[model samples]
Target: MNFTPALPKPFTEIWREAYRYNEKDSPRKSSYQAPGKTPVPFILGTTKLTGGFSVDTSEYPTMGYWSNVPRNEKPQTLLVTGYLRGDNYIKERNTLIESLRILTSDEDPGYLELPLWGRFPVIVTNWDVSESGGKNGQCEVSIGLTRTGMPELQRRDTTGVMGLFNKLENTADSLKDAAVLAFESAVDGINAPDTIADSFTQIKTSLLDIAGRIQGSRSSLNEITGGLSSITNLLAQGERNPRKLASALFDSGKQIVDGIIKIRDTFDDPELFFTIKDNVKNMLQQLLGVKNFFLDVDTVTIKQQVIKEEAERLFKITAFSAASQLMTKLEDPTFSQINSYWKLLQDLEGSINMDDTNIYTAVQEIFMTVAEELSSKNIAAELTTFIKTPIPLPFLAQMLSCDEKKLRRLNNFSDSFLVEGEVIYV
Candidate 1:
């Protein structure tokens, strides 16, 4: 075989041809960036990365080795190796060292980009630098990164996105006496036993107290309050009829939500929206907390139990209905809050028995409405975040580049206490 090595090529032309072939935007594989900061770019070498669905497993003592696995994932992490070298190796290395700053409570996370994998929002966990006097122009760095942003960028169609959430007819009537209808669905075919007439009488006081609380929510929403007083008369009608009592409580719940709606209708301030949501949430909690909702009877008969079950389920459905309605009226509620609200929806969904046609259908309608609302209103998902340990509100606000006062308005704090738990920022 005649070797083609007969033709010797100049190294300059060879290197130029290689560069011409590799000239494209994708040639650079890795970089780092902080919010509002320029990206720090560098060449990368071999990488050892570890990331996937995070899972928790529990080892159990059984004849067959088995582990309990929860349907949850831990945060993804990466072990990255890269290099920095040039004629000015020390300067380049120092520049990288400055770029990969130490992690701190108030520092915004930097992003890491890899060859094939997408860029990751990460806070540097730890890092090591390897150097030797002989290898003056080259050094290898290993870094650990815990990915952030569990509620990643929520992509949606922006075509004709305006008025998406507002498109729904403002028909609060669909929810009027929703509790009554839900309860009736439960006791529809099966008549309540005569012995059970006094079943939920114990909750009478709680119902009235909830109504009174709604009226006292604020003096500004006088229109909603004035109508709430009439619910007491409805309360008397409910005294003998558990369904009617639930309706009265529902009236209270609706009135509170309506008060929030009125506030949202009148004001554009985010604080007012969250304020109304917080107040209505309290009212709903009180209504849901009504004693004897599950019944106190020693032996719950099938008929009696059916009514009781309906009472419990519809009470939640009623409160959640009010919640879902109010959620639609909120302005930029944090995605973190939405996540918590989503969990509440899950609990409500679990409690509902599909066989109960009456209430199930009604509750499902509300579910669909809220799902749409979240899609339309999930604009602040990028702004939402959570912290494990306690951090000062001002510092947390600083980290998010948000105003401290505005942060307070965006989140519900029980008296400017420590801000250690889940936080939402608009």
Candidate 2:
């Protein structure tokens, strides 16, 4: 009998049919699929591969024998090894050698392609090549690659020269404000009287008026003070600029002279006059002395030299004069006193130039000391009176039992006065 038994389907075909049947019966079919093409077995920048190739990956262990807890995983490292062979193996090897050299030399990481794992960005930590003695034209290379996870960013500049300049500018501005505030405070201190008398009140009002004029000037004293805020600002502008600081100082000095003139004019006005008692005359003389201290004898010449140090020196002198005047004004026995004037004088003296040091030490000391001494004595040689008839100074000195020269020294008199109604102090 030549009859053949019926053969079963091929194993692959039978498996496919069985799989189709199972897939229909199940809720869903498994959709797993294999990759379409294998990756090229070569580093992107290197020669073609001929021999067996391998890729190695390693993970650092975070687990310790004593601990059950798992720590975060570390970055992975890959090791690659391959060979090149052919008629042009030498040329190919040279190309690969050159490529490896370039990759290793760069600071930045490079891309790598593998036959099995796909492409990755990696750093070539180390690389080496070997050649056999036989001229079969083949060479081997091994490369160590580390995964470049997240790139590190560069740091920024914070404390540079520009930053330092800004800091200095701000500091200079603050110092300038502090100086202005000190000046204003000193002015307030001088203006405040311990006891309100008619003459003192008038003088205080006149001083306030003068201050008002200074504050209201085209280039105000306040603005001038602000001009000194920064050396840079001073060097820049005109009105509030550094170069104009001297002009502002000059204006201040002129205003002070004008104020003194106004106060002097009041002395001749009958409407402002009071009984010229010894104490009253002393107070008036002190007022005149204070006013005289602010007289700018050469403001025009001073304004020509717009130097910073000169302007600062002038300011100190003005402040000192004002303080001295205040000291004299507050010398009345009825006033509750303070030593602030003396303190301000000392501070100003330290700031002023040594060449200009004599005015405060000589003129103020001589007159003030004599006045204070005479005030302490309280020897009433004659009843306080406002005289209408003029008398000789010699006769008056004789009446007070004081030598004429001694009286002149004590009175700070440069010239003999027609004794008129002015009270004489012995």
Candidate 3:
């Protein structure tokens, strides 16, 4: 039989020496210590894990058991309770306070370091601090941290959408520039007869007013592109949002066409006492046609149509105005005196036509016919004998309602006719 040695009792000299430590040497050390010196266990106070399984239930008489549908796992909550007290309690307490402040801030998904569970991303939902006794600075802290799990990844195709918006903006700018150029060309081509100058001026003023209103609009893109404010209201509606910028461009273009049409219609009366050349009338009609194309056709097609129509319109107006001026010169009695009147009438009747090409050719022929008549007549001798005394030819022509150049040719006057004041016998 063997007998075991008796263990030393409490308060014995050997027990005190084995369990306690001197300032110089120690065999046992505490698990709770100053932070940074050693990692402490969370068990110094309490750590509670709170979570439960989540499921969905529905009543069905056919099945004996309730039908359960699987759902998301319930988030786990970690409740940490601890005390700050020791020789370095003040330092550790301050550090813990600062760390808690950071963890509880607006920063998303704060980090938690659990002694047994490792590190996790969490959100600090609640925190409480208490001092049971006064003046000792020993404090108890309770913190609640909720697990955040993994973050979701987002994917969107924004580049293509942004590119389309940019394209629309560029298209708007180009359309505005084109409209401005067209307007300027139309305005500059208005070589109105003296009888209709007032009416032409009124039309020009109205157009300029519209242009100014567009230029002064509040929207930057609209202002840059001369977009009317009235049309922008459509964009406020969600249904029309997709066409916002394109509609502005369309409206601006339409306004230009409408303005031109209005000018034409205002002077449309048969007995208006003034006449726009057939070509000028046709050009105005075609510009008006641009409104129809813009409204009915797609943007890609409409731009090309507008450009082609504008070029044709400018050409026709310019050519017709020039021809009308020449015709006015030949109508004077001075040039009429040299013509073979019957032959001239027959040639004119044969040349005139509904075809544009034929009409252009006829206009050229008329000019040539007049030139031939003047050259063949050799009226210099008659002109030389007709002038009696020096008189301002322009003033005389103005009084007679005839062209000054025709009067000068009739009296055989020189470029200094303004100073010569040569008068002619009508």
In the range 1-426, model 3's lDDT, one tens digit per residue, is: 111122113232464454345576553321222222232322236768787768755443333444453444677787878777766776766665555565432235555554344345556777776776674757787878776643332112332334333333343343334433443443343332221222222323332343443211133223423434433344333222212333343454444433333433443344432332232233333322222221121223443344334333322332222222222223233333433432433343333221233233333433444344344333432232234455576766676665576565455556555534444544
Model 2, residue 114: what's the lDDT? 45
Model 2, poorest ten-residue lDDT window?
A: 28-37
Residues 1-426 of candidate 1: C-alpha lDDT, one tens digit per residue: 111212223223453342234646235447776555666666766556554554434333233444432333555667888887788877767766777774522235677776555466677878788988887788888877776532222213322243344333222334434456657756766755442344444334444455455422355456665655544565445444555656665666666666655654565455455455455455544533432245565445787777766666655655566666655665556677677766765665566544434344445555665677677654555366778888877788888887787688767876485787677676
Best by TM-score: 1
Which segments of model 2 are wrong by more than 4 Å? Answer: 1-65, 68-71, 103-107, 154-426
Segments of candidate 3 deviating more than 4 angstroms: 1-43, 61-64, 103-109, 134-137, 152-426
> lDDT by residue for model 2 over 1-426, one digit each (tens)?
111122223323454443345645532121111122222232222322222224222221222212121222445666777776677777766665555555431235455654233344555667777888984677777777665544332111332334333333333233233334333332332322211122222333333444443222233434433432332233234223322333333334334433333343334434433321132233323333332322222223322222223334445444444334333333232211223334434555555553322232332332343245334433334223455677788777777575676455344444486565555443
What are the TM-scores, per candidate, against the unseen true structure?
A: 0.44, 0.22, 0.25
Q: Kindly indicate the candidate among 1 and 3 with the higher TM-score.
A: 1
Evaluate model 2: give its lDDT. 0.40
TM-score of 1: 0.44
lDDT of 3: 0.41
Model 2 pairs whose backbones collide? 234-242
Cα shift from native, residue 209, model 3 (Å): 70
Higher-ranked by lDDT: 1 or 2? 1
